[model samples]
Target: MIPGIIWRVLLIAIALVFAGVQLDREAGKTYPLAASVPEQFRSASQFPMAAMALDSDNPDYTLAEAERLIRRRPLPAEHLRILAQAQFAAGATDESALTIQYAAQRGWREPLAQETMARLAIDAGDMPEAARRYAALFLRRDTQDALLEELGPMVLSEPGGAGRQTLIEIVGGGDRWHNQFLRRGARVMPADAFVEIVSATVANGSRYDCDLLNQLERGLTTRDEAAGEGLKTVIADQCPS
Candidate 1:
């Protein structure tokens, strides 16, 4: 007859081996894609549902899985983003909005979260908030030019000027993106509005190089000669006499 302690040891070993085999099987199912291994493994280790959270086609399932993952220690921003995205897709607008804010609070550096925030703000008719979110995105070199191109016209046409001014005040703080914004504004904005923004930036101690001025002049010139001359006059007057 086997000793009770020896039998207990054998049973414990079997249970551990079974658990290991199960874990290995789960890992295989979760990690077929090499690219997702590094990021997804960390989440999967803490919450077994991470695989479904990331891979599920149904937004409702993804949302539920992400919520489960987030309940573990050190809430993952990526999971929060997944939750927010899934919520948005599932027509849970109010919940998605709140979840995205939680994600953004975790880190504003994520482009998708910032974009989602901006879209939500736009849907809420909050242009300033939208511009603020885009401005944060504009700070990223990869996204700056494309966003400037995409949003320049909208800013130029912003009614009440509040949204435009908000962008100017933020982007005008000597970030490299503002130069392109001004150049694009010169072509797309009404001459008066372009001049006013330039004058305002100058008043706030921002200086444009001759190249930028020359580019704006050329862009305005190709669009309208009278407007170009009027812009040149404004530039000259705004400069030290």
Candidate 2:
């Protein structure tokens, strides 16, 4: 009887071990592991591990190590953006600009990427390109005037504010450079006063109707109260109730 019990126990143990092995194999098939690191860089494994460290909120020395790896290997756009952000956080504006530009040139036209390019252009005194990029993004009609407001100083500092006005007129403001005049009247003028001009044109019924009122309302919330009230008076006087 004792021999039979031992035999049964051994058989069950073998079966359990076989089942566990099969389960592991199935899991491996379902979720394949990453390839083994090549024998090139002495710290090749550290790159991804550093990235994981960034994600895990336990960067420790990983950020410094990741910077070294990036300098050596030059990661792809996704990783490059992370490194750029890190540079930005460290107040290394030039390094951030270069890294972001590399990603942008590589066809990463994300909003953040585009904004970074614009910032780089502004930093390099390339006002025309900065204005062009900002206009292209503004025409999407998604960004807010706060961003334009932030860009005002740079635009005004440019040669005669030419690029800034060009961006404003492109978005639907009328000719004769009255756009800036109107924006000033509305008290919404920024360094790039064209944004205000375009906003006024849209708010004043030159474009779509009540459907755009929501956007106008959001703009009003951020605009000068006096300007907003004046605009409301104009709408009440001009547009039908």
Candidate 3:
């Protein structure tokens, strides 16, 4: 009877050993030998869903959804840029600017964000801010001359004549891009108005460069030959030396 009890105990121990081996083999097969769990997976499972929400077919809906997600998780800088753009699309310029500024402050350094901020500053009538942004952009190594040409007049229009001089200084020479900006500025501004503004700015600042002033005078004259004489007459009367 003792022998029978010992035999039963031995069989039970063997069965347990065999079951342990099977479990170990199953676990080895289920998990890749070199597989590592991702850190993001541990942080939150909702990240992917939040990211996907940004791609909704309707821009407004996507923005709204992203805003909701951002409120919940405070997405990374890239996502924040998207959120800023969404705010811009919703006509919330102030909010968009703030968001983009946050990204910039956080070292995002996205060109699009800088450009958007510059545009926002212009729209907000903050000429100084616009000028600062344009200056920084102009100094960038990768700045596209074509884009600068398109953006120059708009930047110049911010501070009126003073801004025009800055644009001329930045543009320098008869580069095609600079000429394009000059032509665009001329077309958009009335010849008399531009002349008057430039004259006033020149009068106020004694340190103004003669060559730049000459270039502006030439540009104003070439804008519309018919209007040039009239503009000169207006300038002479309104802004006499």
Scored by lDDT, the top model is 1
- Total clashing pairs in model 2: 1
lDDT of 2 by residue, 1-241 (tens): 9999999999998997666555444433442211133323224343454455454444434456458657755755655766676666566778877877787666434456667777878888887778766654453345556765576556544433666555545544444433333433223234224334444455544542443343353465466555455445444544556
Q: How well does candidate 3 match the true structure in TM-score terms? A: 0.39
Query: Which predicted model would earn the best TM-score?
Result: 1
Residue pairs with colliding backbones in model 1 are none
The sequence of per-residue lDDT tens digits that candidate 1 reaches over residues 116-211 is 777777767777887787666666556645655555455445533766687668756765666766765664455655666676777677777656
Candidate lDDT scores, in order, read 0.65, 0.54, 0.56
Ranking by lDDT: 1, 3, 2
lDDT of 1: 0.65
Q: By TM-score, highest first, what's the ranking? A: 1, 2, 3
lDDT of 3 by residue, 87-205 (tens): 77677878887899886555334566667767877788776666556655655546666665566666664444555555444444334343343344354555554454444433554
TM-score of each: 0.61, 0.43, 0.39
Candidate 1 ranges with C-alpha deviation above 4 Å: 1-41, 44-55, 72-78, 144-156, 175-195, 223-231, 237-241
